[model samples]
Target: MKITVLGVGGMGSRFALMLHQGGNDVTLVDGWQANIDAIRKDGIQANFNGKPVSAKMPIYSPAEIDQSGVKADLIVVFLKSNQLDAMFKRVQPIIHKDTYVLCLLNGIGHEDVLSKYVAKDHLLLGITMWTAGMTGPGHVELSGDGEVELENFEPAGEAFAKQVVSVFEGAGLNPKYSHDVKYSIWRKACVNGTLNCLCALLDCNIGEFGKTKQAPELLHTIIDEFAAVADKEGVNLDTEEVYNHVAATFTSDIAGHYPSMHQDLVQNHRLTEIEFIDGAVARKGEQYGIATPYCKLLTQMVHVKEQLVGAK
Candidate 1:
């Protein structure tokens, strides 16, 4: 399969490397010059299960997309929510009518942005629990076991979804087709709303945050807020179940890792996806006359932190 991985950052680099090594023709496109340059000079350096794996695949910046003359059978998007629109537009030339665009991006409102670029029939909405972090330019550290759930939002995309799934499973990506992926997306967002944001705000990894006594009380409140918002949107989120799912990330397996949000707003000194995650919940709650005080406050605090550090 000819695939184009848009936004070759931490998560992007991980999947790109796997798919390429799995014998698919995969090319990468990202906004970061250093990442592209590093991959071009050497190869993407990645560690999986405590073992180092290296592979050479063509990596390009957005400006070089069309000139690469590649028509992608699939476009796996791993972009941050805010950067989706412009980047998707730049990669449009490769998206033919039969091409499937699978978005495994974090947070919400991504399909709204993506729908503007591709037909609903060509759009595949997905959520992945896979955790990957960039070590440096063109380098990533990936560990732990994670799977992805994706679905076709339109009947026209069903066949495409199955085709994509076969390819993913062939690459050992472990994918399942979800008839209702919104629930999964919302559940993952709930995890991000808590672990991703709180860890970023405190400048700590999950282990450090979990060690604090206040973690449970804070988790309860945040999960309640997210549950309320999700309920309003018809996604039934069991607070206790959701809380447990999120708390599992604090174990020794992924405890030392800071989530992608922390890597974005802190390590990389860039803007975050809070607006599309917690902030999105807050907005939906507002529309439905539900109060999301926690999400609203967290969103405000993250924005303030972004301003303090001059994030864009």
Candidate 2:
């Protein structure tokens, strides 16, 4: 398959390398000139399990993508939500009419924004439990297992979802087609809401947060409020199940790893997805006439921290 990865940062670079290694025609696109130049000079440097590996493929900036004049069968986007608008605009010209655009971003509301430019049938929503980070430009470090759940929107069918899953599975990432992707996305949000914020606020990794006394209590509060919001939204989410999942993730193979949110704050980048996880729950809680004081407070605290750090 001819694949193009837009926003080739951490996860995007990882996916691009995997697909290329699987023998697919892969091209990596990013806005950063240093990353593009580095990959073009050398190769994509991927550190997995503390061992370094490299994959040679075409890497280009958005401008270069425009100059190439090549179309892709599939385009996987892994950009921050704030960059979505401009990124889509830049890539629109290169995307073919039949290209399947899969979004592997965190949070909700991305599908709606993507649909405005692409056909709904060509859109796929995805969620991942894998943890990764960009160690440097054109370099990515994989911290744990990569598992993805994907599904198509209203105009797509199961066959399309399976085709998308096959591409990821071929690349060694365990990808599955889910009939209820909405619930899966919500579940991921539940987990992210409980842990990511706590990690950012406490400046700790998953295992370290689990070891703290206040971590579990705060997590319980966040999950409880989030579950209430999900229930009101008619999304089936069990608090106990969600809590157990969050707890297990800390002890899982990815234990001791810091979440992307924490990494963002440490790198002095603005954390926007907090608005999608905790802020989303709090907003829905108000609409459902449920109290979400804890969630709201945490969201405000994170915002304050961002303010102090001058994060964009």
* Clash count list over all predictions: 0, 0
How well does each candidate superpose onto the true structure, as a TM-score? 0.97, 0.94
- Once fitted onto the true fold, the runs of candidate 1 whose alpha carbons sit more than 4 angstroms away are none
lDDT of each: 0.88, 0.81
| Candidate 1 lDDT for residue 139 | 88
Off by over 4 Å in 2: none
Model 2 TM-score is: 0.94
Best by lDDT: 1
lDDT of 1 at 15: 89
Model 1 lDDT tens row, 43-137: 88998779999889988888887788878888999888888888987888888887888999879878888888888888999998788999899
Roughly what TM-score does model 1 have, to 2 decimal places?
Answer: 0.97
lDDT, candidate 2, at 288 = 83
lDDT of 2 at 108: 66
lDDT of 2 by residue, 152-241 (tens): 876554576788788788889899888888888888887778778888888889898898878778878888887788777678787778
Q: What is the lDDT of residue 270 in candidate 1?
A: 94
lDDT of 2 at 53: 89
